[model samples]
Target: MRILIVHNLLWAHYKASVFQALQHLVDQQPDLSIRVLQIARNERSRASLETATDADTPTYTYQYELLFDRFLEDISLTERAQALLRHARAYKPDVINLTGYYDPAQLLLLAWAKLNGIRVVMQNESTAADHQRSGWKELFKRSVFRACDGFFCFGSQSADYLIQLGVPPAKILLRKNAVDNEALRAVYEQTLPNRTRLQQSLHLQTNNFVFVGRLIEVKNLPMLLNAFAEALKRSVNALNWGLILLGDGDQWAELSQQIGSLKLTDRVTLLPGRPWFRVPEVLALSNVLVLPSRSEPWGLVVNEAMVCGLPVIVSERCGCVQDLVHPDETGFVFDPEEPDKLTQLMVKFMDDLVDTQRMAYYAQQYIAPYAPDVVAQEMLDGFREITN
Candidate 1:
């Protein structure tokens, strides 16, 4: 099979999941030819091309300065459409897979592919309720979807969403985001030594609960901070628990202020974002992983945390909650918007940290089947059936 995947690649960090899935496909089927046309972000203008592996897989990066300009959205769309069309003409892939949210460029590319007798697959993280919010973009998206052979979703909820959007039932494939299990396992095994070193360097306690991801509005950092504060105030042994906030975003200053206002400076610590490779170590060091996202399409980090054997507390709004989290069995699921409920869950986890570790063990066992290779195989099977 010759496949072409279309998606934006900003510094190659964003496409790790896709690369993992495709790499698995290449490894399993050596006859497969895969080409990626990565649309570089503005900051990657002078970025050097780096090969991910020694394999014969060819990745081509195209520089587009105006790909993310808000004022020149139409121009950017046209530019991306032209670039994809040029690549399609040259590569002529057997199947073209489109990932990410609905956009004009994606619609145009799908239309062009359909006109050229190419099989098209659209993969997105949105549910049906979310699709209705797209308004006019939904119409364009539907048009492109109608021309496609199949649709791929991250979970059953998303697959059901596409079905509700009137896509045929057989066309929806539920494939979760792929993770490198071996790499994760290796990281987990090596994390104890690294965690001790990091603890000594940062002077962090061993019982701290960690929250990662961007500190944005949808992430519900304020509610998390409030919840942590409330938990600390109510706990009989406040000194036994600590909080670590990882990653940085637009809400950093406000979140920092909230922590200070709540007098949680001693209990809660804010850490800057680290490289993707170091995330497993961070997860290993923490006693629990909290993802209080208000509206996350799919929380891949939740899977990563669970794979690292950390108990997770994710919001029901998170897509991964449906698949990865099983309240009391694997981890807990709380409402992201309900700070009080989040606080209660946090307090409950802190009170039962040993039980949480047992839950973390179950989480690792439960998520074993959804690893990268398994997901890639499922994807390949779907594509083969769709194209047949």
Candidate 2:
């Protein structure tokens, strides 16, 4: 069997880990082969998010191809479609797994696959809660979904959305997303000894609620600051607790101004986004991980934090919340729109009302099943089921 996966970025280390694991599985099967065609290096807006400074090459042990050395969005739609089609025709895969349905260039390849009787698998991270449903877009997506042989979703939320669109539940191959937990945990453990020195050098408090991601509007940075301020006002341990904002975006100046206006400059620190591997270094010095995105499909940061044994405070709207976060167990989930609710959860952490160590243990255990190897095996099994 020949399987070809169409992915967007070569610098997505998390995806690379899964691809590596999948390749390892395929190698064990003498009759199977898998290759990934990375569309671009990274998106323009997300250039800062990448740790690699070069043309975004794969560092893992896998058979893959880089179609372009630049961002795909910079390429013309016609050029992209032509390149994708050329690669698909040359490979003549028994099955083609699309990254998502958002890209029309990939959709053209999907259409061609259907006409040629090649099995198609669609991987979706978008949930109904991520955006407002459009009747026309729904109609178009239903047509697209109809051509696919199987589905791989981010979580239950995403899988349920496909079911609502009339897809049979049996067709949903995988409903969970994962990161390289063992790799991330190893990095975190290596950085553990230097946690004290790192925190002291940065002048960060020993116990802090850290938010790591793009400092954009959708991340709800303003609300995070406001909620942290409110929690400070209500906590006796306010002096010992702090907020760490990690990542760079266009909203830096505005977020800085808001921090000043809220009189939180001394308590809040904004750091530039670093590579995925270095995230464990940041998580080492922090006590809790917080993601307050107003609209997040699946917050993978939560998985990274959990792997490092740090409890998370994620938004209820995030797709990972239902599958990974257990309310008051692994961590707490608050409504992003409700500042007061977020403030209360923050206070619980600050006041030591929640058992951080206990919750952290639960977090690590809950995240074990969502490892890259598990997800890769599921993908392989799904391919076999469809092809046979």
The whole-model lDDT of each prediction reads 0.72, 0.91
- As a TM-score, model 2 comes out at 0.97
lDDT tens readout by residue for model 2, 1-388: 9999999998888998999999999999899988899989889888777664444233678888988899867888888789889988998899999999999999999989989999999999988888899889899999999889999999999999999898999999999888889878988999899988999899898789999999888999999999999999999899999999989998999999999999999899998888887788899989999999989999999999999999999998899988999988899888899999999999999998999989988999999999989999999999989999
lDDT of 2: 0.91
Lowest-lDDT window of 10 residues in candidate 1?
A: 57-66
Q: At residue 302, give the lDDT of candidate 2.
A: 97
Per-residue error for 267 in candidate 1, Å, reads: 0.6
lDDT of 1 by residue, 37-65 (tens): 66654233222232244342323232222
In model 2, what lDDT does residue 131 have?
86
Scored against the true structure, residue 93 in model 1 reaches a CA lDDT of 80
Model 1 CA deviation exceeding 4 Å by range: 10-14, 17-24, 27-31, 41-75, 128-135, 194-197
Query: What is the clash tally of candidate 1?
Result: 0
